[model samples]
Target: MNTIVDFQQFNNATLEQVRTRFEEEFGVMTYFMNPAPRPCFNKICMSELHQSQTSLEKMQGEVIANGKVSQANYLVLASDIPGIFNLGGDLSVFGDLIRAKARDHLLAYAKLCVNNVWTFYNMQAPVTTISLVQGQAMGGGFEAALAAHIMVAEKSALMGLPEVLFNLFPGMGALSFLSRKIGMPAAEKMVRSGKIYTGEELYQLGVVDVLAEDGQGQYALNNWIKKNHRSLNSFQAINRAKQRVNPLTIEELYDITEIWVDAALRLDERNLKVMERLVRAQNSKVNSDVAHIQEKQSA
Candidate 1:
């Protein structure tokens, strides 16, 4: 289904209005949205379908708003759909732009959203941003999730950076976030393989914090909020210090994207076959090991 996302509407909202609107929308008073405010932190939820220019802009505004609201509480940044979080830069937008030879404009728009998330990640808000995943969070969807300090996934959630499948790479800071959180080896596996994860596996890999069963997710989040509320100053201090000590840089992300894009452009059916073979080989090895252990027990 083609969801019409409106960005312009979101971009036009004043900082204070955005804050109040979000609070009213989510029934959470402790949080608000103020992207421009430096020390803003509070409880909010940033989510959208990201279908059009307006949609993307709205999500961006929501993130900025969350930054403004970051005070003593955390925000939940999620998409409307439980199954498909974000499919990435609107292919429709790119396909039309590319056909019309508006490549530069397309690139500029894409970069704008990417950079906005980068700013969100580095915001000085005492906000503990969490990504709530329900369905398929692929490409930029996965990238946006990575921007948060934590990820909460429903058991049915599927996550991956599948930009390679489209002959592109993660233009956002997804590669950087993945590398920092999961290390280069695992991150490379995720990108090069295009293998997605269930919430269970993601939790095991430390990508998601809570493996919630539908409605229970909010309670888990509330529990997290309660635990963090008393130590807001300390929580912010530790996070800020950690960022200062080992922050993900834009240059590093650019370099990673370039490498992945190069690989993506070269990817074809032949490479997919090779990747499948590698996966089969790895799975076979694992099964063999499991069978051997079973045999020893039986003996």
Candidate 2:
């Protein structure tokens, strides 16, 4: 566990240069090769909203290329945050854009998000994508998790799309991915309910692929990978077949996003007030996480 994989020698200088390594407690490391035939772990540290999205897009490009050239069999998307996978869209930016009536800018952001999700959903490369959710994944965060070919979540983790609470919807592929996973009716119910479900609940609802015990997410991921390694080709083929049967097109997502932008623009003062409150909640969560890390370090 103490040893780090030296990626520079692999001639992937770009990845080596841009890859980030978080503190040990966060358990975040990106694009590190595992033992023979094991998938590479690509840690995604979701701290800032725009920065995280940009980073994820870049990671996706690298991963797609890496899989093609290096033949990396698996790619796991995980977080560096201890108790929060991602809080979702940048509410602060949303608030500003909405207030300023910047429809084009908002649409651009949504498109960027969809581009990343579309890439993951299609798995353009010959690699299987997995999402390891050890904590809360809300709104766009939940959509990101759903984009993966497989979702492995810890029992204590929570996932939900709370956009409806702020008088909006998760437009960046949430409806598309969730509907495909659990059917349209069920997906619509969950989105409108705005309720957060534990990993166990989602698993029972057939949304979560693997449910692991708390603090054992990494172990569970490794175990699942090992178990599926021999049948990887079959597993990947099944994923492809699933997509073919229920195709999720980029055009569909873009159309939904346009609706989302229009809805956002029409939000009344009360709705914006609620969104502002949610922004405060997100900031509070970030502060709490910082305090937790500080407490742990001081201990």
The numbered model that scores best in lDDT is 2
How many collisions per candidate?
22, 0
- TM-score of each prediction: 0.64, 0.81
- Tens digits of lDDT, candidate 1, 1-299: 11222234554432331223233232222222222111111111222212222333334334324334211244556543324455454444444454455545554555555554665566544455666676666666688778877677777677887656545566667667877787879887888777888878888987787778755665776666666667766876887787787777766665555554444435565544544453354345446656787899999
Off by over 4 Å in 1: 1-72, 254-299
Judging by TM-score against the true structure, name the best candidate: 2
Instruction: Report lDDT per candidate.
Output: 0.54, 0.70
Tens-place lDDT digits, model 2, residues 15-91: 42123332222222333211111111122222122243344344442322322322345656676566776667777
For model 2, what is the alpha-carbon lDDT of residue 11?
36
Looking at model 1, residue 54 earns an lDDT score of 32
Error of 1 at 130 (Å): 1.8
Candidate 1 lands at a TM-score of 0.64
